[model samples]
Target: MTGRFVLQNVKTINGIAVDIILENGKIIEIVPPGTGIGDKIIDYKQKVFVSSGWIDLHVHAFPELDPYGDDVDEIGYKTGVTTVIDAGSTGADQISDLVSSYKNSKTNVFAFLNISRIGLKRIDELSDTSWLDEKELKKAISQYGDFIVGLKARISKSVVGPNGIEPLKIARKFSADTGLPLMVHIGSGPPDIREVLNLLEQQDIITHYLNGKANNLFDEKGEPLPEFNKAIERGVHLDVGHGTASFSFPTAEVAKKRDIRFNTISTDIYRGNRLNGPVYSMANVLTKFLYLGYPLKEVIDAVTVNAAVWLRKPELGRISVGDIGNLTLFSIEDESTLLQDSEGEKRMAEKRVVVKGVVINGEFNEC
Candidate 1:
């Protein structure tokens, strides 16, 4: 087995041109034009855009489970994403099965240990106290700590169903005990937003940051809630989970104006949300940020470096030498497109990009 490949004539997000060389499943060199020869050469002819393989910090393509669907690896390759974090798609009781049957057999997968016992199946049965057993949660974590990167709890009123913050508190305790981060799903909760944010510490994640009218980040007065700032001050990370009902445009506009930055960009790619709003591809999310006045470089960073940092997987999300030889090749197009948010608001993007190819561990495959 030879681990030698060459990527030629691609432009970085910054528009600086370079050639990338991958060998032995690692990036061995990045040189100017005419530096190396290889058995395989991908000449994009300046049409292909190169960036660190996109990382969707959130997704729910649980193939082993019927509810979440089975097209995760295909979706990632098609969308130019090399790695994904399955956000609570499986619960503590079902995680090992999901990991073995779905994650280990296919593409790169990191999961959030669901606070629920049954995971994403049987939505009607998911709730506070009834489905959550912290002891089982700890056992699951202990059993699959390598693949289970963090804790996940949906602290929404509708989801919790009168349990209040008890489930969330339990999740936090488990997270603290396990020494992993907590990824909280915020929206549709009765408790004050500030109080919820106060409980999370630095490196913890607050997903669905742009949801509105559900007692989310903004208050009744439409001002940036103080707890939001406090959480950021405490190093709590914000993520655009972008589910079917999250990512309101008005709130996103506010977030842009307030200069609130995202720690990562992820598609909550589940069965229910893939065809609805925001779409599944991380590149399209980058397009949305571009429409919101984010430069291409910044958008790329959010999906790559930012997400890798959040997961503490330094090997991923970069094209540097000695890094994982993963890359996403895409084409930027100037097209008029209507983008929809959580609230069904439409915004048009002047330019958008599409994934062309993906290289995973030095194997170049078209998306």
Candidate 2:
């Protein structure tokens, strides 16, 4: 029920204690601890931290695809993520089905329309040039409008096959025509990472930037490549997709040492990675960042404010009066936890971020 409720004595990431009053799915007031009153009072007593709901910028939410699909809520609010962006799990041919599938879901869902008409029905979606149907792609974007946030092109070796950099070139043109940003997945590449980075304009995202693949953004010395620096200067966004095969602890360590940071932290998560190694949940992925020596605020912001700002939905990034009551309640537990990256490297974290519950659509769901 979208009832009046008071989340009392909850702490912000900055450690400020406050009471949040939510009514009819909107935040009515944020007051001093113990001051706000409502019909339903759920007091955290300053033990829980609240922030704008977590937004996963990259996920596979089309449950039909075998290797790269999942139920929306399975990776969303159930795991402290109130919103998820399906990262091109479907394209023109199947985006409608993907959209229809999530209509009854509690989690807020969006998608990046794949340039290929077939999408991830097969991993090498971009291998066929015929699947890059501009007409159908345009039609899907026009039909979905805002529901389709941007375009996603997996411009790696396996996904692109012998087509090389051609798919990305078309994707760039599509981005220009549609006025949408591109979220490009990078991995082992014969198209060459430099060519991919060169094609991306300002605001295009490079997911899996820290992957330890030979064709990664960093050089052999763990220093950023000239093209990578150029891409950063062009305002290309870096994302930590952290898929089952992406994300390397050593690569991440190098990035941390060199001060290379992610604009958004996402799990290129599907059923395999979520239930197996590496990316288990949003909290699990955040914990790895914590182990990398990032502060709680920066790590949390990667999934919250940073993602929201990129999505052009600033209202989803902060808690304020008159905004929708979308938030995640979590805590830092001082317990030793073992974390593993995609490379099978392990690190022991002394502290972990744990999700307690989430407030979405004016209703609270305990994790």
Candidate 3:
């Protein structure tokens, strides 16, 4: 059975108007205005905006957990997000369940192999030497390497404490040995932000790149940390993982003013923050960034092509011909808004962008 769908006359952030055609779960063509017909047509009438489907690279959703507790499929299906990479919410022991049960049954899911055995539950330090099993980690990745995209380690002050840089050292070694990218959660670490960032190799990701707090990308002089610039120079990826306790207006504003371009934009969504303030949806994240001076096309790329590049899954993010039919339709709303970051700084936006529908694998799912 062939399923046909068309999105007509939608404006792109790049000032292009086209009709996108989806057939049998793949994008068949994108024709300039007045050129396509399909079984189903959505005439956006220039009112809707189009972009590549979003890929949230640093989410905390898991399938086995409650719908509220890190459920990847629920969030992805509901938020116009066709794909998401769970940022190390499940460790070696729990990955088997994820691969067998959740990975096969839900919205596209990928995971960063948590360095800890128990994952992020009931424990603060993931570097517990006793539970650190290299053998098990290797086995999990070897068995389920496709779904296991990379490694996740939270290098924050409250999480890692004053353990020096041993945890980071271990995570670095793991990434190096496995030949996979490292998704490092950066925020409040004690080893000085410079030292921690220096360890990140090329292609490694530094999430929460714009968190406003002590031990962040800024120094007392309000200039970016030396190592942060160094990492960028070395081609290290910067990711905006706006979590409940991450992302501040001060940080975002400063980064934007400095013209620091993030390699990717993502939501560090979890059970608690899904319905709360700043964590509404990826479109909201896009809106905040747009207000912060990033061009709309660049903002779209942050959540789409840029994120997919980091995951090494290039086909999942773009809407090019022959690619899976992952599409997002949005509208720009005129309004005044106040957004709060983790540090409680308030920022205002004059408009908000809202998603109208998502098409994943050519299947229509309206949100």
Candidate 4:
């Protein structure tokens, strides 16, 4: 994966035409088009768009797990996402294996360690608060600080069965202790959305920000809950974790009209959702946002810069000399393509974002 390479004549989201130069595993230089040379050059003569490689902040790509698992590359390199965070797919008991399996992967894989030590060993990891062993979690965080980017606590009725908000409280404490971000999942809540949002600090995230469930962001009149609005005002980030049952296009459209926008866009993609109707890929989920009328650059930033910033991995979000050589080469195909969100609402996309390939660690991979 180590080599010297150059991408020629590509435009960035901001409409700057530049030649990107890569050496070893870092971007050594960026110059005006036709002004850089390298040992191997990709003459991308067409006006394709280039940007820092995309990051899907909420995907479950640990293939060893059943049903919900998927191959890392399937959701990573193959889908134009260079970095994919496995959102609580594994916990302390299985983290070593999770990290070990991804060491040789072309796609950068990371995780928000599950609050439960058993980690998604079952569909309901948080049903019993006893599963959340602070002792084991602290040890794993200490051991895999670099690999464990954050902590994940699914705060919902089904997952948190009698425990209610205790799991989230534990996750917040762990984050406070380790100085890491915390990702809290919300759905059909026993610990109501307000309770969860009130507890979340600036860096903490609320995934599934827009769903059709009873506990959605909007009130009966389709107004943003005052509690939710205040949380955002206080700097809490809303993430579009478009999962199997989460993400309603009508909800998103309504929120958009209300001036509500998610900080990051993710698919929450796994084998079940990827193969099924809703989230085909990160690109697919991103396309839905485009359908919601987000500007191209703004949509791109959600998957790239905003995602990396909230995940606290500042190193993977930008394109510049001395930055990691992780780039996605893509084009907006001006065509009519059918797109659907998790709620079965459909739209005809005018410009579909098509992936040409990607540069990961200085090695170019074709889609």
What are the lDDT figures for the candidates, one per model?
0.79, 0.92, 0.78, 0.86
Off by over 4 Å in 3: 63-68, 101-106
TM-score against truth, every candidate: 0.94, 0.99, 0.94, 0.96
lDDT of 4 by residue, 1-367 (tens): 3588889999999988899889888899989898879888887775699989999999998888888788998899888899999999998899888888887688988899998999888878988877888899989988998888888988888888888888888888878888887898889978788888888888788999988788877898989999898988888888999998888878888899899988999889999888875898877787777777899999999989998887667778899789878899998877787987777778888878889889876678878
Which candidate wins on lDDT? 2
Tell me the deviation in Å of residue 37 in model 4. Answer: 2.2
For model 1, residues 296-326, the per-residue Cα lDDT tens digits are 7888888888988888887686678888677
Per-residue accuracy of model 3 over 1-367 as CA lDDT, tens digit each? 2388788898777778899888998889999965779998878888888777778888877645543256666568678888888888878888877666563443678888887767776346554654557788888899989888888877876667657677888888888788988888887667678878889989888898888768889777667877788888998999889987778877777777777878898888877677775676777777888788777788888888888877777887666898877777888889897766777777789988888888876787778
Cα RMSD for candidate 2?
A: 0.9
Give every collision pair in model 2.
none
Compose the digit string of candidate 2's lDDT tens values, residues 246-270. 8999999999888888999999899
Off by over 4 Å in 4: none
Q: What lDDT does candidate 4 reach at residue 296?
A: 91
Name every residue pair that clashes in candidate 3.
61-70, 62-70, 157-188
Pairs that clash in candidate 4 = none
In candidate 2, what residue range of length 10 has the lowest lDDT sum?
Answer: 1-10
